[model samples]
Target: MNLDSFEQLAQRRKTVKVLAQDSLPTADCRAVVQRVIAAAGWAPFHKICSADHRVEEQFSGIEPWRFHAIDADACRNLRSHVVHREAAGKIPAMLASADAMIMATWLPNLPAGGLGTASDNESFEPTLGNVEHIAAASAAVQSLLLAATAAGFETYWSSGGVLRSRELFDLLNIPTQQRLLGAIFLFPGNVTKSDKVEIAESKLRAERRPASQWSRWVEVKQ
Candidate 1:
């Protein structure tokens, strides 16, 4: 795509929190979701060094990040949990309104000792081992969101507290070793255009720092 077209696409992409309660017209929303996810899989990943003794001897293995798409019915099932109960009213509504919710998870490289003591793991900076994987997964999510935008879908990325609960992991049949990054709700855009008004109002009420405010060009003097 040309630079102008790319810019337009970037400008058009927006987070849609409240989706209209309408099923996507397409007979196969799953297929569309799969396509978006496939596009996401194209994101570049930094390979973990297998040759390093620290990794080869101490670490188990690295698994690629994965995505799971949950439909409304499954979302409803999640409401039974206490963790989900507090947001029960809103959570169900959001789930019911959206066509599907996609979850991104990071499967960490376990220690050779296999889930060693928390203190032992903490000292080793176990979280740091998955940094590259998380970074790649984030890029994949961005690609998925952008693809959904191009397909004329409204999308919302949410890091709801309930997502971290063990109940959700069991419900989704996600492995205990996997850590959820977040969920992306997808559905048809608001036809009444009221959502856009809300978005505009939100932007008006918030102050966003421009790139110049946070970025700097570094110069080195030898």
Candidate 2:
């Protein structure tokens, strides 16, 4: 890939959703995920993530983002767990079709020893650090998305419905202080585009207006 193709690659990226059951899951896309995650490290971040939290000990202090990737077997286990919980709405279909799932999380700078006291949604108190952390993580996620796109894969960034639960955190061995940024699901491009599987494109993609409509130059005050 060349710098000139960056615009084309960006344009080629789109949200493709596949709801197939255990079809493309047979492919091990973790290598693509690993390379893309390394590419994601190149994303810009204004603030360095704190490694003081027990959850962040494994990674560099500079990265606010932490990715936990699960393979097909793990996906199947998670699928079973979700089904057993009776909250398996669209999750099972996604997991079944995914070659792998990335549980992307961001470390939040919180009050000292405040993990015990969390909101109803298990989120921490907002801080300037929290905002930057999310931004950095989101940029990293976008880099991964584009990398996956370049690798001939279809990706879905989901809001992680039941995946944000405390039980899941414990099951996945994720620290409680980390917050979910995205539940990235990867599918084989061929399978996703094939007539054999049912695929759904994000309707919001077509609804996007031109850049001029959503962006503008800042006015200068004399």
Candidate 3:
């Protein structure tokens, strides 16, 4: 795509918190999800290790993270435990109306000196060693969002608290070594021109400073 087209796509991409009244077409939702995730996998990652290792093996390899897609039924079942009454009440309708919810997780890399058979959470350290992997996972999430926007789908990246709970990890059978980054909600609705202003206003979207404000070209002086 040309520069203008690319710019348009970037500008067109917006976080869709509130979905439209209609639900996504079930028949095509899976295909759309697959395409977006495939695009996410294409993100440039620093692959320091292989992912095809056994559970017993020490996971020292730094590979791209994994994404899990949860359907409406499962989302509803999980949302039942939401503490906030208003949020809980809104979840079913929101989840039912969306195409799917995608969970992004950071895989833990086992240290060389094996920590025995202890759980991942107990053994793993969120230090500089795994920082690159976390950055790669964030890139993957961005790619997925861009791909969904290009495919005429609205997307929302939410932590939602529920996804981070221990209950969710157990329910999803996610390993303790893996850390959930956040959840992405995919909707079928396209934000119209008229609705764009309203949505932007509702969120009080922050103004971003120009590159001049954040960028630097400097020489070190001690």
Candidate 4:
């Protein structure tokens, strides 16, 4: 398929569970690992990450009060609370086995109020800087997923720990100078349908949301 056709097909694919532990070849798995690093290296904010935590501190210019909004302590607490809620299953072990993880970072640069504005999710007004950072990070992430799919691997991102502890970052040797973006989890082969098959219908029925509510109406400016 051409790039455009592939992109279309990829978008329709859902995030399914992977259960094949030993079926994937070692060489192919290694190739996926290399591609993940390359994708994240080319991901947005690539130039901003460094091995130094001091760099991240320097880049984040928020004042004391505003800085507390994205507090590491609070994030940790929240993540700790949710970690055990996952159903007992082999999916976690399987993911840890066949896939690799990447913790991405962004250059810390934001006006004082920019940090606090995160609490105001009710407003529909555009915040240019936040929007741009989100867009850049999203594009980079989607590119990684699409690239993995093209390579015949399945991938998903889990922000759980990356959103909470600095462990993932520290483990990855991510510099303190870089602001953590998130983590990408990947594996080879599509997850067997049986793994997800049991709950798929229930999830679809219970979790469905109206697309119109999520989609924005576009208007062209002449």
Candidate 5:
């Protein structure tokens, strides 16, 4: 609740990618993932839910977002599926290392007189409701990342790569109308950052703009 603690939490979170061979015990991963999800669910959102999506009862009625999680064993299976299917793009090697991952999706509010059959080509509806829904869902995704970081687990917010494909969607049984926002990976079992560990870090990770450059003071004068 304190500002200092919040600042420290923010500083601790970062994207880290590890090789497929690196992994944590399934038991530790499962427990840590549960806590991480509990933390993520606390993110604020303006709207409650979308009319089209059927959210699980266990989620406590949060409607804009839905998460499909895969454990370490599933992660390995997905990695195999990715390679076997030859899904294009920079396939993640960390799939082998990750103990768990959640494919986070947002429900898009359809326009008036429009059906909910959204496709990849249909990026988004230019409606106010849709915008708010997307933003809320995105907030939930950030919450997931922060929660994972708070657990002292290595996390990666991936752009979804093959995880966004139709094949994967059908495999996970995620509803078609929902849009994929992020693929969050969690490497548990105290995977501390080490110099010897070969990780996939962004080259621009160190380049950060100061707050003054990114923010400004505004005033309305008579």
Candidate 6:
């Protein structure tokens, strides 16, 4: 995408807090959720097999954190676990009630004996078969995100929770061979900076690495 297009999408996509007080209409929410999913369905992705992979059904009254468990498990498998901070059954709603939602999960048919590094270090390299599959899955999710933004919705991708939990993979009915890629949440809310809530300064700021750190990895030829 062009810089102008990327900036517009980035500005529109904000990570809104899934406040307990805020609520979304069930029926309307479901419709867009389906659309976001359908868009991903239309995107091209690797055809990986899942011996036991299954996503939870759409059930009313399910909370947001429950969905977080699934995300949690996925992250754990990838050696990037997020600390659990809430009870079960509280996550689905956060997803269902969102303005829109997007997800990147391993579909059935992934090649057997997926790849991984000795440790989490140097694990991002695509040489490992599974890692390469995940990279492809992420690309597909990016398509879904951009499509949602183009359609006028805010979006954010989260691989923090489920990238590593094997049990979660089992619960989601995902086959032992398949892996969960990522999840994205989208909202119809406005993205202006003025509407943001102030955070306590006591919170530790996240450190960002400069792009130069990875410049050597990029192939540049004169």
Top-TM-score candidate index: 2
Count of clashing pairs, candidate 2? 0
How much RMSD separates candidate 2 from the native structure?
Answer: 2.4
Clashing pairs in 5: 20-96, 20-97
lDDT tens per residue, model 1, 1-222: 899987787767776665333322323467777888778778777865222223332234333566778765555444344323655334544554565778777555666775443231122234655788678778878888888887777777777456656666677776555557778877656534453222211353247677799999999999
Off by over 4 Å in 3: 19-28, 49-62, 80-93, 111-124, 190-204, 217-222
How close is every model to the real structure, measured as TM-score? 0.74, 0.89, 0.73, 0.52, 0.86, 0.50
The better candidate by lDDT, 2 or 3, is 2
Tell me the spans in candidate 2 whose CA falls farther than 4 Å from its real position.
Answer: 1-4, 22-25, 54-57, 119-121, 192-196, 219-222
Error of 4 at 108 (Å): 2.7
The residue ranges of model 6 lying beyond 4 angstroms of the native Cα positions read 1-3, 27-93, 100-103, 107-127, 160-176, 190-222
Report the lDDT of model 1 for residue 100.
71
Total residue pair clashes for candidate 5? 2
Residue pairs in collision within model 2: none
Model 4, 147-177: lDDT tens digits are 7666666555545342324443444344333
User: Per-residue lDDT tens digits of candidate 2, residues 1-222?
Assistant: 687799899988899888865445476667777898789778888787765554334665568888888887788778878865656577777777787788999978767866546543366657888898899999999998998888888889998888988888889987777889989987778873455567888989999999999999999999
Better of 2 and 6 by lDDT: 2
5 against 6, candidate with superior TM-score = 5
Model 5, 81-103: lDDT tens digits are 77655653444466666888898
**How do these models rank on TM-score, best leading?**
2, 5, 1, 3, 4, 6
* Residue 8 lDDT, candidate 1, scale 0-100: 80
Candidate RMSDs in order:
5.9, 2.4, 5.2, 9.5, 2.9, 9.7
Highest-lDDT candidate: 2
